[model samples]
Target chain A: MILLEEVWRTFQVGEAEVGALKGISLAIRRGDHVALVGPSGSGKSTLLHILGCLDRPTRGRYLFEERDTGSLSELERSALRQSRIGFVFQFFHLLSRLTAAGNVELPMMFAGVAPEERRTRAQEALRSVGLAHRAKHRPDQLSGGERQRVAIARAVVMGPSLLLADEPTGNLDRASSREVMELLERMNADGLTLVVVTHDPDIARRARRVIRLSDGTMEEEAP
Target chain B: MRAPDLLRFAAGALSGHRLRTLLSVAGVGVGVAAVVSLTALGEGARQYVVNEFTSLGSNLLIVMPGRVETTGSIPFGGVTHDLTLEDFQALVGRIYLIRSAAPLAVGSETLRHGDLGRTIPILGTTASYAEVRHLEMASGSFLPRRDPEEAGNEIVLGTKVARELFGGENPLGKLVRMGVWRFRVVGVAAPKGRSLLGFDMDDAAFVPVRTVMQAFDRRTLFRILLEVRSRGEMEQAKREVVRLLAERHHTQDVTVITQDAVLSAFSAILNALTLALAGIAAISLAVAGVGIMNVMLVSVSERRAEVGLLKALGATDGQVLAAFLAEASLLTGAGGLAGLGAGLAAVKILTAVYPAFPASPPAWAVGASLAVSVLVGLTFGLWPAYRATRLDPVNALMRR
Candidate 1:
């Protein structure tokens, strides 16, 4: 479902040219559960950003569904990201002013869903996450696990084919982390291609495929 | 998102920061209120002046002595007393369109009634002066229509003069002494308050014009008040007056002023003043606009994470810009309405406190204030909304 051919990403910090991702090549088929694992400064987040179409590569090609994403205009890229890809941040990133249902309905709003349908689908998504009773609660009012569940519901509300989670349980306690991981695993098992970037070995070992990076270059890939 | 949804979202975002939203709204409100109330004052002043002029009677003309229009060739030392009682007589008998003519002779004299003495301005005119100038009588009769010499010894006391001289007792038929003449008060004038030039019309007395001329040893009338048959005849009457006066005096040494000319000139000056006042008040609205801009910029910076999240959820830069602009427009629109209500209340209070003040704000002023507020919001809100659009989604989220 996604392919990267010798992709490179560099940053100009002051007078120094810092290569965040150097000569990386990878591929992942549909319905695959992949974990991108690396230490700090290893370009794990940067690589995930590239995969999610949130950042552009400095060199080479990024193909999603056999279409080159590098040549797409900014508007076209935004549309592609909207309809096909979903992102879950470690912080959950739920709008503090909006209720859980509002957060779940946001992606569909961007997708131009009818208001009545959006309301119904938002409630359904919340129900799937076991947060239907808390749908009217704001993110700050919810527990850490509940907030993450809201974020997950929001991510899947648009029915995207690809889901990218960056340390989705980084701020959660052990039990909450396990619940979030199991929720993600269940979604992946239902055939939504999931790519998780994490430092947790337990979470990484549960993935069907693992890619490790060091010093901005891929060091190992285990199937 | 749909337009309604976008508005809803923006409103929700603004409501979350209640104090900031209120302050911005108040800024716009004060601006609109300033515009509304100041224009009301200006418009009120204009209406007051127009009302005063209309109350002085319509289709009236004043023929004053002196050549107001001077030619360089006419030379100096060419002063002339061009208006007289004869000219007034000519208009009464000769001019076909002249409805009435009142010759006026004014003087200041001390009036004595028993032990009380007061200095009062005296208007010297015929009986027609009352009808021509729209002056009402309180009791008895106005300068009686009779031989000038016989009417000369009788006087009509104004309301204030009668009040001061006789207290509550009827002053009619009472004797009052003016200078060397002992006059019998035949009538009391109704209260006319203050006329133009700060002269209290209610604090004076009226006598036959010949009486004043004879007492003051001056045959020249101060002014001749001419009443035209209708408003349509005013221009023709003025032309005939100039011709008749020029023929009588052997020179056009007179100025004929139509009520309309004076009214138009006053209206022009008052209109300009009203515009200037409104312009000065509009500046406050601009200051309020700057306040909106400041608040919007702060709001943009504070909501960087939300902006990033929206972008990540696939909102275009255009969508974000539209959202913020909508928010700004909503703030200003609501504030403008509130300000309009406040301004109307203020005008009402002012009119209530001072019943004589016109204090009615014009309709265009209200509409204009509202339009300007929305425009100010859009103009001031650009930079912050642009900043929001330019934020990179990934970097914004990573900023923590």
Candidate 2:
């Protein structure tokens, strides 16, 4: 579970100050399938970055499992991200040189897993996503749907409690998008908390909870 | 990370762009080759000079007339007519450190042994020339004391000259023509090979000093070769020779030089040559560094999204830095190894083509070249690696 109180994020473009996220308060519970939906420049990406621990709010108290993430050092924050969080992107950003299995094994490598154990886990992760036969293929060798499956397997390989996907099906066709959405739904049903950021109403309709944003402010939360 | 895993990753990454990596590595290879080749040349020339000086004997000294100029022309055409028999006698009798003194008068003349003839070098000296020069006899004897006094028409053939004229047969007591003078071969000197000046030491004929003076009509003294008791007394012996020569010649223009002085002068010349070569090699290294930097900057720009992806996936800033550093080092290290191989191959080729010239690469040159390659890698890689590590994950991921 995670909590944010009075979160504020500001940026400076040349000489003028701009607020990307202002006074946002939210809570994410275990096993909850949540969707944050907003239009372009509505601060949805900024909120996702904060939730992923890739960025810190300028003014906020962020708690991850009762530990004050706001007070954590940079190294501790990196360790937290490595151990308890997984991220997926719309572009399916995988290492060009690495195969699907190699991309999945990256998180285990960061955690100092033994090579044999990392290999077994990576293979199992690929198989769970119906990509076992494509384990040795690089991202460029895979189709759009297969690349997103590989990305999902990479995200869940570390057995993280929280999965944050930013536009998980943004770049796929309708059928491939449905397949990727079904994969996320299956994982959420298997007790992994999922948070998705999207602008599609049909995609947001599947989540158990929906949080809508407008102009850096949370406008509605529905369950 | 474990070294094996790091190496595996590096291999995978580098192999992904084989042509680019090889080209970068080749740049480094050329740098190392320049360093090794130039240093080897310096070492070879140094050895040649040292060998030449050692061949003249360690305790030997040469007393020349007139001062040696550093960078200016000599008005008297050097010390050709300065040294004389009187100066040689004064040093031998007055200098306590002198073991023996041999006055040498040298010239070139055509030699004939029966039907075979060739133009060879001729040295005219006393019987003491053998003792002063440490000359060994292969067969027969050297000129006797009475030979110089009686102006004996006898000659000692060098090993090569003897081999050329008589093949395997003995030439002692045989008559040979030396500039119209028919002289009997008294003895065959041992083989001395060629000196560093490219002159054949074993291709000369030696006759008594009196015979050369009377028959060849040679009167001007060339060089006075002095053999001292030991190397420790060389400085004292040279001082005494200079003093005696200065007093006899009634001027201080004469020079007394020891083997150590000659060695130092040779080392100085080698030092200058080494410096010049090292400077040129340094420019090659700089160019190699620039090539590496250029390639790495391009790589960083192209891999911006990958860098962000890694950072988002939990790679620390240090890990990103180390990855780039490792890539650069691997490239340059390969280059260093290639350069070393190429340089050694060159040395081998030169040795096979010209056995008389020394062309061996020394251990120091190899070590220095390797060290320089690593340094170049670190220096050129730091900037690009820093640029990559400082990239914001948000901006980098959003880059097209």
Candidate 3:
């Protein structure tokens, strides 16, 4: 469902050009659980952003579900992001003012879903994440693990084909992180393509396959 | 995506910062209120002038010494001849439509009664002048139906003059002195609060025209007042008088203006003044627009992360820009309505306190103020909304 061909992302800070991702090529099949593990400055976050369609590679070809994402317009790319891809961040970026259900409905809102259907779908997503009882609670009122679950519900509310998570458990305690990983693993088993970026090797060991990156290059594959 | 949903979203965003939204609304409200109230005042003064003119009889025509087109009363550097008593005699003597004619001669003099003295305006006219102007007599009679040149030696005191000179006593047969001439007061005029010809009638004394002309040593009358028999015959009377004066004087030097012409001209000048005042007040609205711009800029800057989140959630650039723009117009639109209500209420309160002055906002001013307020929001909010749309989602999401 995802493919990258010599994807290179570069940035110019002042006058010198710096490369964040250098000539990286990788492909993951549908319904596969892939973990990207690397140290800081290893381009793991950049790769996750590219996979989520939040940022475009400076010089590379990206194919999302057999369609050329690099050739899509900004408007088309935004449509692709909402309909085909979902993202879960480390900080669980839920609007603090909205209730859990409202946070879950954000993506569908931008998709022009009707109010009644959006509400129903948001409630269903919260129930799937075991947060139906906390649907009316705001982000500040919810615990950290609950907030992450709400964010996950928001991510999957649009029923995206692929889920990209960048450091999903970076800000969680050990027990909360294990619960979040189990929830994500359960979704992956139910046939949702999952790509997770993590610093902890223990988390990566649970995935079907682990791809490790060093500097800006893919260094090794642990089978 | 939909307009209603966009509006809802914008409203939600504004609700996050309650104090800032309220302050912005207040800023625009004050501006709209200024526009509304100032125009009301201008309109009130205009209505006041119109009321005063209509109070004077509409069937009357004024023949002044100068042309209406001329700026000054003494046109041609004081070389133009004045209207005389002979012209007054000729008009009433010939024109059958003329109900009555009163020749006026005016001067400022001191009136002395026993040991007390007060300087006041003296209006010199025949008995017909009272009937022409509808002057009511509180005591005795006005000027006593005598010929213009006979010098009746009779005087009528205005209510104010009578009160100041005679106190509670009847001033009917009392004698008053004006510049070495002794005159007996024949009547006391009633209180007529409206002023005519730029002087208060209540603060004046009435005497025979020829008596004043002879005492003041003047050969010309200041003006002549001719009251037509009916309002329908006014135009014919005007033409007949103009032709007669042209035949007698061999040229038309005097300006004959019907009361309608004077009233319309007064109306036009006052309308222009009202528009000018509205323009001055509109400047304050512009300042309020700047205030809106400042608030919108701050709002955009403060919501960068939220903007990024919206984009990542699949919101198009147009949708985000429209959301911010909606927020701005909503503030100004609501403020404009509130200010309109406040200003009209203030005008009502003013009219209640002083019933003499009628203040009301014109429809054009009301519509223009509302339209300009919305336009102000769109114009001032454009830059901020554009800035919001241009934010890079990746960089914005990285911020706290």
Better of 2 and 3 by lDDT: 3
Q: Evaluated with DockQ, which candidate comes out highest?
A: 1
Interface Cα RMSD in Å, per prediction: 1.1, 1.5, 1.2
Q: Which stretches of candidate 2 lie over 4 Å from their true place?
A: B63-124, B127-151, B155-206, B210-256
Where does candidate 3 stray beyond 4 Å? B56-60, B66-101, B107-112, B115-121, B126-154, B177-186, B190-200, B208-220, B226-240, B258-280
Q: Best to worst by DockQ, what's the order?
A: 1, 3, 2
Q: Write the per-residue lDDT of candidate 1 for residues B1-400, one digit (tens) a residue.
A: 7988888988998999899888889888988888899989988998998887877777788888888764677457555755777788887888899887788888889999998888988888899888888888899999888654344688999899999999999999999998789899999988888864346888998888888988788778888888898989999999999998888888778988877887888988988887888898889888888888888898898888888888888888888898898888888888899899999999999999999989788899999999998898888888899999998777877765
TM-score, model 2, chain B versus true chain B:
0.74
Compose the digit string of candidate 2's lDDT tens values, residues B1-400: 5556666666677888899999998988888888888877887888888876776676888766677656356455433336656666667778888887777767788889778997887877777778877788999988876533346788998998999998888899999998668899999988877743245769988887767766767664566788999988888888877777767666566777776875988888996787688679878988998999998899888889888877777777777787788788888888899988988888788879878777676787799888888788878988998999988887777653
- Chain B TM-scores per candidate, in order, are 0.89, 0.74, 0.81
Chain A TM-score for each of the predictions: 0.98, 0.97, 0.98
lDDT of 1: 0.87
Top candidate when judged by TM-score against the true structure: 1
Each prediction's TM-score versus the true structure: 0.90, 0.80, 0.86
lDDT digits (tens) for residues B1-400 of candidate 3: 6677777777877888899888888888888888898899999999998887766777888888755564465545434567888889999899999888899999889998988787888889998988788888898989978788777678898899999999998888889999789999999988886455776888899999888888888888888999999989989998998888877777676878788887888899999999899999899889989999999999888888888878877888988888899999988887899889888988999999999998899888889899999899888988899999999887777675
The 10 consecutive residues of candidate 3 chain B with the worst lDDT sum are: B70-79
